[model samples]
Target: MSNFLLQLSYLIGSITFIVGLKQLSSPDSARKGNLVAAFGMVLAIIGTILFHEHDGNKIGNIPWILGAMALGTVVGWMMAMKVKMTAMPQMVSFFNGMGGACAAIISIVEFNSHPDGAPGYLLVVFLGLIIGTVSFSGSIIAYGKLDDKIKDISSKALTYFNLLLLLAIFVVLGIAVASPEVFGHDVVWLLLGLSAAYGVLFVMPIGGADMPVVISLLNSFTGMAAAFGGFLYNNPVMLTGGILVGSAGTILTVLMCNAMNRSLLNVIIGSFGGGGASGKGADGEQVVKEISVTDTAILCAYAGKVTIVPGYGLAVAQAQHICHDLEKKLEDKGVEVSFAIHPVAGRMPGHMNVLLAEADVPYPKLVEMEDANPGMSSTDVVIVVGANDVVNPAAENDPSSPIYGMPVLKVWEAKNVIVMKRSMRAGYAGIENELFFHPKTKMLFGDAKDTLGKLVAEIKEL
Candidate 1:
């Protein structure tokens, strides 16, 4: 009877997971979906602790288990509440790394408990160890890069070295499985060290622009590792949860790669961003143009249609609310206002969407890149707020550019474009924007939040 109840709980939990993931496809039901899934998880945990038994013995260590759960809950809640919008990507990487570490530690404990287990059992243990270790180390590196604490270390020799290191990892895995007695207990530690090294080197040279893809890939690795743990323990709920996370992460990674017009292989080996080669303007020389706050307001207020493009700088300045205010004010003046969002716009996937959603912007008002481009030529004015690479013309015009084949927003096709920035510095890709020098483009120099606030005030007075 006890075993039957436990299985029932797992079945309920698995159903909730699927339902929650489906609801997550749209923003309207996302919060409710998350709560439902969390409730299911809690139910499963309670059922397992109360009813699980092995060989007529109930589980022990209740106090320790409950204490650990309480501590982790407090820490996770506090961190989630305190993180800023700009640091969200780093926070995600940090938390995901923790998950990977937990999975890796589980494999270590299991292997140590049964060092001379069957060959098939050892294979599952070894596979979990390798994947989890790599995910943990790689996620940490990705966190460092997103937080701007680490710089890309790109070199042709490093690329070749990484390939060789990967080869060595597989070779070691084969040997460990073929003859577990060759290195005794020491082989496990050796494999751990190699996996960790490969993970670090793998992410060391990847640039900031490719971070979304890396995050997604590492997340899948963690899921795969967790699934292996589920296999080792024969836990149905654990297996279901792990498979869901792994498959979801993989699908998201593929979508991101398609949006960037780059293959998974190219993303791994290209090292496309961070001090890459630059592309010059169409005419090989730049002509400067500038605009004032009053002019920007006047132009936007009287325009028939206006579109706003946001980027990482907008998140850095915490300007999503003020930008939304500007949008509302313009709409009041009989101007049609909407946002243009690129798939890879900010630090992570769906970043810009989340930022705008936080500001209570309606879902219908946020237009995607492919949909927004067709209307660019008819748009009266385009306001680019803290965006850079997404609007740059080099992607279409320059074959020498590293981001040449990647798709970008066609704001240059609009009637007039206003770019907001503090200076003439390059973007995250470390390259100049050819759009800044275009005839229809004008620079509005200032911080995004302050400038947008001024625009809001100016439009109100008109």
Candidate 2:
């Protein structure tokens, strides 16, 4: 009866995971969906502790497991409560790396426990070890980059070196798996080291702009490793959770790659953008037009339609809430305000949406790139708050640019554009925004949060 109950709990947890995942598709239901999935995970953990058994051993290490879980929970909660919005990507990478490390540790313990396993079992263990280690190391590197602790570096030689290193790891894996008896315990350690090294090499050559894709790919790797653990232990909940995470992460990675007009192979080969476009001014020369907050506020107050385009700068300035405040003030005067969100905006997919939703922006007011572009011509004002690459105009106009084919927000199509930023620095892709020099564009130089707050005050005074 207890065994049956455990299986039943696992089923319920799996269903919740699926339902919660589906709910995350919309911003309105996302928070609720996350809670539901977390609840399901809690259920799984409890059911496993009470009922899981293998050869009647029953995971006899409850004290350690409980203590570790508690510690991790406390750490996670503290970080979530204290972390700034700009550091979200870094936090994600940290948590994902922890998950990968856990999976890799499982593989290590299992392989050691079963010194003389079946050939197929050995293969599975090796697979988990390699993939999990890679995810763990690569995720750490990604976290460093997102936190600005590491520079994005890529070269033809480095790319080729990574490819060779990957090949070597696979070769060693094949040899070890084929002759487990001869390879013995040391082979696993050797593989683990090689896998970890490859992970660092793989991510180090990837540019910062490609970090989003790397995050998703590493997530998929962790999921796959966990699935292998499930297979090893014959745990249904573990298998289901792993499969869900793996599949979802892979799908998201593909969507991000497609949005950037790049292929997975090319990304892996380190042929994509990671460094910003330096000194590549739009049309070889720039003629900037500056706008004061007073004038800008007046323009927005009277405009029929105003579309806001947010980027990494918005997050950096922690300005989403005030931007929303600005939007509300504009709407009071009967202006139509909507957000134009490029899929690849900010550092990750759905980044802008998440930021805006946090600021209580209505879901309907968030316009996707494709839908926002067609109506841009009619938009009287486009407020670009701390965005550079998405509104750069290089993607559409410069065939010689690295990001030439990527789809971008058409903020330039609007009649008037107000770009707010701290300075005249290149975007994440290291390219100068041609839109900045466009005849109709106006620069508003200042901190985004400060400027938006001032703009809100100015609009009220008007």
Q: In lDDT terms, which candidate is top?
A: 1
Give the worst 10-residue stretch by lDDT in candidate 1.
Answer: 274-283
Residue 331 lDDT in candidate 2: 93
- Estimated TM-score per prediction? 0.96, 0.94
Per-residue lDDT of candidate 2, residues 1-462 (tens digit): 778878988998998899899898876798899999989989888998888777766767899989988998898999988988778888999889988888888889988898678878888888888999999999999999888899878777887888888898888888777887666788889989999999998988776457799999999999999899889888888898898999999998998899988898878884556443433643465578899999999999999999999999999999999989999999999999999998888889889988998999998999999999999999999999988887777788778677778898888889999999898877776666778888989999999999999999999998
Error (Å) of candidate 2 at residue 2 is 3.3
What's the distance in Å from true for residue 427, model 1?
1.6
* Local accuracy by lDDT, each model: 0.89, 0.87
| Candidate 2 clash pair list | 207-274, 276-429, 276-430, 277-429, 277-430, 277-431
- Predicted structure 1: lDDT: 0.89
Q: Give the runs in model 2 whose Cα sits over 4 Å from its true position.
A: 274-285
Clashing pairs in 1: none
The residue-level lDDT of candidate 1 at 270 comes to: 72
